[model samples]
Target: MADDAQGATTPVLPPERRTAGQEHVPGNVLVSIGALLLGMLLAALDQTIVSTALPTIVSDLGGLEHLSWVVTAYMLAATAATPLWGKLGDQYGRKRLFQAAIVIFLIGSALCGLAQNMPELIGFRALQGLGGGGLMVLSMAIVGDLVPPRDRGRYQGLFGAVFGATSVLGPLLGGLFTEHLSWRWVFYINLPVGAVALVVIATVLRLPPKRTRHVIDYLGTFLIASVATCLVLVASLGGTTWDWGSPQIIGLAVLGAVLTVVFVMVERRAAEPVLPLKLFRIRTFTLSAVISFIVGFAMFGAMTFLPTFLQVVHGISPTMSGVHMLPMVIGLLLASTASGQIVSRTGRWKVFPIAGTGVTALGLLLLAHLDEHSSTTEMSGFFFVFGLGLGLVMQVLVLIVQNAVGYEDLGVATSGATFFRSIGASFGVAVFGSVFSNRLADQLTDAFRGVRLPSGVSADSLAADPRGIQSLPSSLRPDVLHAYASAITDVFLYAAPVAVVGFVLAWFLREDRLRASVTTPDVTETLASNPVERTSYDEVCRALSVLGSREGRREIYRTITERAGYDLRPATSWLLLRIKRYGSVEPAVLAERGPVPLTVIIEAARQVEERHLATRAGLDLSLTPQGEEVAERLSRAREDSLAQLLGDWWGPDRPTDLVQLVKELNGELCGSEREQPYDGGPAQRFA
Candidate 1:
């Protein structure tokens, strides 16, 4: 039954039991979660799997010069599409859009497998990225629809595991296909997995349709897309395809700045903005976005060069380089899983971000000290520290952002956090790529300054082909290896300060408490429709909290009377409501448990009878038919008002949780079983 403001009819089910989606059944949850994980796996695995096959792709397509574009195309497209997909899902239904993403992804995958050249492959990968962005953003949005906020940590951690597992598996599978089968299999593999995901979502997942009329913000979309595209190109192509100081890069940079100003202006005025400017007003949301961007910048920037160091300086094969990166992956998985359980059990999260980012800074500092002779154990430990820090920080930021906003803005908030991270990654890769190239060129030139070279061979030739260093005189190998090591170390040295900035930002994050329930879009809309009733409910919570038992009982009566237009006094209304909520009660029992005196209880009962609100049958008192209707109206009004006021602090069952908290507090006040103090220490600072 729907909650009515008039309180004319009351559903037998309590407010806590009702939510936007279907009732939480074990079978249904498993089915829905399973489908979502499959979709996530498909998206994450693609990012890494192609890395191992890039050399083979370059060889087959004869585009040795255009190799970076293969990855750049995908990253740019995904980054640009993320916000649009998120806003669209909020406006329309997510299921159809989600399914459409899968279909588009599968089509891109199939076409990519059939590509005959580098241009075709790059074009197809861009298409795949467009779909891949939706798969990621929509999957998170759908999970918000399926799970409540307090329990979302466990699921987010599991998704982190999917990313971790694919990080390890992607390169191995990519290598195997490139060596034994074919490089095309990297793209072909997604086709089958995506199909399975499609089937699962179609059969098992159910979501409510969008009923509200949406004003699509087409102008905002154009401006935001333009900003994202220009900024990403400036990052991706600058210092590589075009000089950083050249007209092409300069023009893109200027264009990006101009579009950003325009986008912000448009969002402030749009009725339904793609990314609401108001969200930045929330302290946690803004702080988390900043921290996420910094982490992405340092993490991805450092990661891009690790394999190069292993290959050129440490002399490891492509497959072994992947294996060598396992410490970070293992550390990420363990920390992510453990932190998730702790947050769910304790409901404290501030410490994770604070400590995690500090650890990240320390890890990067240690990595900056590495040289050609650094031990394997030392390198592994540094990688592990960085990964552990990431695991703790990344998932929690998403969780914090989701909880800060109402259901109406949940998708936009999640996407905004993701968008910043992606942009940071792009910037880190481009800036560091330039640094590595320049530093290596300088070091290689210096290393070969006085050395005699083979006829027609330059230092650049030996730098490009490491195998040529083997053919060089034994005396020169050390110098060349030292140059490669120093250049790579320079990359991490640059990243360490960036990670330190992230650590500093973590202190500013406001530790807002996580809510127990995911606020569904419907609840937000309901409150929006009755803004005045929402204010009344907020007043009821404050008034109820401080009032004595008798006063609190009377306030409850007053709240119901005001909403329902009833004229009953506290005693009569309270007596009537007691019967309605708790069913038939004997007069002796009512007197024993009464907040007022026994005389007051007896007098209230008599008044209720005189008003024909209830009747006496033997020792048991019950509401009459007319009394039942009045009681139902009172109950509905009370519930609706309270729900609007305290929804943020509520769990899946707002009424149930609220009642339980009150009872527990009352018991403690009376010196019953004392609740254990939370041992979170500094972590509990927010509370």
Candidate 2:
């Protein structure tokens, strides 16, 4: 009796919490998503908004030497803090932690706008990055919590759209603010939008306390943060601030390597590790991380030189260059949105990253052939293909990792994937910067060979100020422009092979069917329900949808019969369980509940009665004493079959909620038509 009571209580969650983000509270979903997107936009915008404002900032602050740190500090802090924030959200609660991130970001943003010098600006930006990291990862984790994998595509796609939008808009907005207002407005602009998002989230995004003992992994945090900071500094500073072989660069590299080794050891021993090493064992998790990293490496690495190419070779203004980037932006938005809808509807996704990487390589190869004579239209076309490839790879890769893990690992898993991509982006920028700078210098030296009469002008001066290339003598200007174009082509040539590596890695991705619910689809309804309202009954119907086709029914039958070690048709077992449920119900009533035909019901009854498993008088049906024992065993058998099918929950024992979820999911097998496979086979791949 005590055990039974404990079982009953286990299903009841502390108190039902409702939020717009939770599926159960569906009304507030749009508002909640809007708020989440607002936060995402702020983080993404910050990464780019400072780009066009940098010159103005440098002039005002008089710190040209420390210019790169403006961006590097943010990236370094954001990358290091990502995993830690995720782990904390898992322990303390995502809602409060997310809100805290917003506040921190706001504080940093406000301070950034007020900074009088480069050091203060970099410090405030780092502070902002701490919060920005949390905002990004937590928003994604929240989506995973709210939406099932199958339905997540559209939301993730929207996020991709936001990212793409910000990429183009950030520079334009930054330039406008710097020219028309103050350079500081670039940071200050986040204030009103962030305040609105904060208010919306606080009001609409409620979640139950999922707190536990906060065994903060202080050592792991310190080690990983040190490693991230050191690596980012090396990437941002090497070959520019210091030579690649300089002691400063070498020291940072050695420090990063040692810190990484210590981080791994610390994680192995830490309770509630920041990034669980066990996740690496999952093929999807590990593979997705690699693919994400490579995508970032190739994409960010090569794309860094695009604006310079346009300004020097094509003579486009900064604003015009931003405008000319439209082709890539349009392609990305279309590909991401379309692919998401297709995946949500069809549930087949493995083909995307494979094809995306292939296209990315193709795009880079074509770009390697670009020269001084390349038309703007031709350049736009290449960018479109590259953008499409990135679009297809980015959102879906996260979905794959999220689908592979259990619920408890969602936050860490999402954050870890983002972290790898960020690290890749940092390294890509550095490596590509070094390659492009060296090649450009070599090309200019050759172009300027044996030339004279350009008084007070040098190759280095033209390289720094691309605008000055046009202002030089027409005879010399063409040589400089051609040299700039040739060097950029070499950068693309170098980046193409990296993308091919991603293509090869994508082939190993194991395609698993996306799950229909945030948690596994089970029949157990954890919450108390009104049988009359039939919410549980609806869930059962949804689960039955999985078994609507002949293939699904066959799998279930095969599973059950294999356990029985004999051909035990579902009719007999189902009838016995039904009899137990209704307590001697009329035959018509039993048939109605099962939606069983009269003839099939009669046949099952006769077979059970013959075996002394059930008996019937007139229209009424009852389980015989022997039938009760047989039914109990069959029920346990059903549970075992379900456990095998649904995948295991993450605890010592399966929760009663899962039992209820599975039971609720087993709604009467409505004869719904099986959905046919989508005939459009990887159209997004071609885009």
TM-score of each: 0.67, 0.67
TM-score of 2: 0.67
Please provide, for model 2 over 1-687, each residue's C-alpha lDDT reduced to its tens digit, 9 standing for 90 to 100.
000111111011111211223434334677888888898888888877776666457557755445556766777777777766766787888888889999999999999999999899989998998888888767765664555322343455466567766877977787677767898899999999999999999888765445545688878877877886787678767876689899999999999999899899999999868678999999999988888777777666554466556655786655666666667656755675566556656778799889888888888898898888988889999989887887677657765666787755654675566667766766666566666667777888899889984676777765554555646888887888788888778888988888899899999999988754322111101000000011122232233223222223434544554575545555665566556543454555444433456676677787788888877666566788888777666656655554454444424675565565454323211111111111212221100
lDDT of 1 by residue, 54-113 (tens): 656765675433554566567667767765676678677888889999998999999999
Lowest lDDT sum, 10 consecutive residues, model 1, at 524-533
Question: For model 1, what is the error of residue 622's alpha carbon versus the real structure, in angstroms, after optimal superposition?
Answer: 18
lDDT of each candidate versus the true structure: 0.65, 0.65
Pairs that clash in candidate 1: 7-633, 148-518
RMSD of 2: 11.6
Model 2 lDDT at residue 398: 61
Candidate 2: C-alpha lDDT: 0.65
